[model samples]
Target: MNRSHLGVLIRMVTWPKKVVFGAFLASVLTAILGILVPWVTKSMIDSFTSHIDVTKVFLLVGLFLINVILSGIAHYMISYLGEYTIYRLREKMWAHILRLPIDYFDNNSTGQTVSRLTDDVSTLNNFVSKKVPEFISQALLVVGSIVFLFVLDWKLTLALLVMAPILTVIIVPIGRRLYTVAGETQNEMAAFVGKLSNVLAEMRLVKSYSGEKKEYTRVMESGDSLFRLNLAVAKLQSIFSPLISGTIMLMVLVLLGYGGLRMADGSLTTGAFVAIIFYIIQAITPISSVASFFTEYKATSGATKRLYEIYSLSEEKVDELDEYTNIFDGQIRFHNVSFSYNKNSKVLQDISFTAQPNQITAIVGPSGAGKTTLFHLIERMYTFDNGSISCDQLQIDQIPLSNWRKMIGYVMQDSAIMNGTIRENILYGVDDADEESMVHYTKLANAHHFISSLPEGYDTVVGERGIKLSGGQKQRIAIARAFIMNPKILLLDEATANLDSESERFVQTALVNLMKNRTTLVIAHRLSTIRNADQIVFLDAGKVTGMGRHDELMNTHRKYADFVEGQNLKMAQ
Candidate 1:
């Protein structure tokens, strides 16, 4: 809010020479044309006293019309420059947000980040494009006016300068309050957007719970807060604007009375009096523009502060090596790996295990036993606190994030599906995917038959989050996506846990095809998944309790035996 805000403003402005030069040219024309009109008016008035000069009258009228045209041109150029600046600024923010570390997203809401990127940045665009240009031309007019006023009569110019300090004393205090209010309004706006996005995304849950009134109340409170802040701004402007105008009018009245006496004594000519009136009237508009520029700048600083925090954040480290290593064929080892979210008590403690190349490593435990947290760690969605997870001989963090992630293909319990054609979903992160491979992978995943049966086949649009497709269909689509990725390490996190018996069989079959000859990690409660794992690592309260094949664990570990028996997994025998 202080000197630091200037840095944010400077960063937000984009200077394309063509646009900058155009705005500058138009601004100069606006100021020069404006300054000339009043001087032409003075000449017309003086000529009227002697004899009516038609040419002078026509010239004065023409200058006024041209001034209007120049003003319009200045506005258009400035506006174009503003929109261009915002477009580039948004591009940078979007890119930076994508590269930002996972912890940033873990701590911040999408609503707040999106609000800064879109709405808050718009506030800055308005100031830079519209307000700053106006201030510049107004500054020129004000300076030009003062220089001429001193030339006309130095005594009167000094008298007008006395008002500056009084105006400053009034504006400074209210400006601080306005800055605080503006900040609160922006924050409330972000909260409101976040709430609505969450509610709408989960609208089905809300309807089933009959919680409409509760959500309405929460949303209304945020809206009410914004309204109050906006009202405060309105009230401040109502007082701030008129108070300055009244002072300027009082100065004008004083000038008129003094000039009238001077005329009576023949000390001032009629032409000089008329000319002074013209200059003062012309000076009024730019003065108000100058005042508002300062006041509104205080408001824009709030938005600048929000964006400043985002820009200051460190991005995820990605150092691409000279070559991509085929590291997945080597075993993945967790050496005393421990982690916690927000430094709370550890979620995983001294956990160590290994998954060999091209084998199924299943993780199983009760809910809240840090089962899914294990997958998150292996994917490097979070960094562990007290240990090292390495592929081959290199620590995972030492490997470039891109290199590490490129080897992984994850399919979660709830399929991640965007609203797009099935082909697009299958080819989501894949590059240069051919139509032939698309069909081949879908066939491998057992998806080609159902897809070909659909009227549009692979071109069919899935509704948001694949809502139009059943659970098994979504799973097959995800499996097809995994197949296309051809990753070395495939992660299946309870991929078949939610499907019905019939759907589970089909999806299970597809998953077996997808997992074949890949270093696979599966987190499951399903007996079928556990029964097939080459190695089953049992986690109890974040500690490694058993590590063996399912049959070995059933004989050696009573907890594993009871857990599987409770699910009626014993009946399969």
Candidate 2:
């Protein structure tokens, strides 16, 4: 492992230092007791050949019982400590993930991120909690067994030493291969999970478009890739386990043969031979543990690298400024502001506009003309490259991100609604909203009537993304959500785009209610929706071509006039 991985290990271990240390000490004591058991048994065998006292026999049995009980206690504590540590680490990792910038989510898949938090963290947790104690105990046993072997006969100890290099030669290359395969398996598993999540989320679309066979084929392909990678890892383990076990058996056979010759010459006692054989078996157990440790270490290193990559990302900074409280005067200005999702191509170029207090500013544009991007910029979801955006003459960047967002309400094109009760979804961000306020806002959005008509009334559950609600009902609920915020600025992006004429009429009325006495920015798809806008900013190819009242732009700009005429003709048809 490198310094960084070692550092991560140290930090995790030290998080619950007292518990970890206690577990480590208990493991060491258990290993010492294990080493003492063989010596006691050898003494008992010699005593049986001579004279066996009843008290001595009982005392020996008691010591063995004590060893077993102590070992069990130590094992239990180690397990407990390991679980507690894993819980704390996972919580910290999850909190960090939640606070990450919006752009990070744009580039990474939700499934992959979930895999790291669940699968990868579990891998690390297993190593830290189970393997670490086991490795330490095994190391102590190996050393203690070797010391006893040398005491019995140095020549026999030297003979067993010959097997160490042979074991290393067999284990090292296979261990490296196992590590490589383990990493590939994890990556494949993450991809499979990502694909599964995407398919499940879009199941409605799949059935609607009759793409079930295509989706099934795609899922099966991902599953096959994961299966193959896992099989490769299993194959390497199959080779490794037998090679290490066979080598240990071979050493034991050689020891038995050599000890028999010595015994015939009266050079070794039966008790000594028995003890040496027991010690050799004890030594071999740790050798197997060491092998397993190497394999686990390699796999854990890969997981550690993935987690560190996420931890290394810079978090979005929000400075605390007492001058900018959670309030906006509803005056917004963009002064030659420019931005791009990728810096190579500008999405919003040199854009300048002012949304006056208590007035409606409608942004009209072609599909790729950066209408939604403007809302993203205002929310500071993505930072701009040049110029500035100010609210009430105060630079937006100087305000706290939380305070800035709190002062504005947003209603998206899809009318995003989380899975919850009608009341719960409406009061999502505004937890302090009273029952009276909720009812008033819902009524204003024309959602209260439908909600009251439901069997459960305000308590009715909306399935995932409000799937139970119609498009218009979802829009009204969203509008009610924005209404409850009572924000100084309201952003409406295609608020009435997906509704039927009657639904549109209700949503449009709710929107007009929401816009009362607040600076509002509307991204309109149907030109008629924004016909009464205080100012219409016409955009094409990421630049503003005209800004004025709708009627003025209809006569002054040919592109605007052409857009209006086309919409009117479509309405007539």
TM-score of 1: 0.92
Instruction: State the C-alpha lDDT per candidate.
Output: 0.81, 0.82
Per-residue CA lDDT of model 2 for 346-401, tens digit only, reads 99999999999878899987779999999999999999999999998989988888
Tens-digit lDDT track of model 1 for 302-347:
7567787787788877656427566846578889999998788888
TM-scores of the models, in the given order?
A: 0.92, 0.92
Clash counts for all predictions: 0, 0
Q: In candidate 1, which residue pairs get closer than 3 Å at backbone N, Cα or C atoms, i.e. clash?
A: none
Segments of candidate 1 deviating more than 4 angstroms: 1-3, 9-14, 43-69, 318-330, 500-510, 571-573
Tell me the deviation in Å of residue 66 in model 2. Answer: 2.3
**Worst-scoring 10-residue span by lDDT in model 2:** 1-10
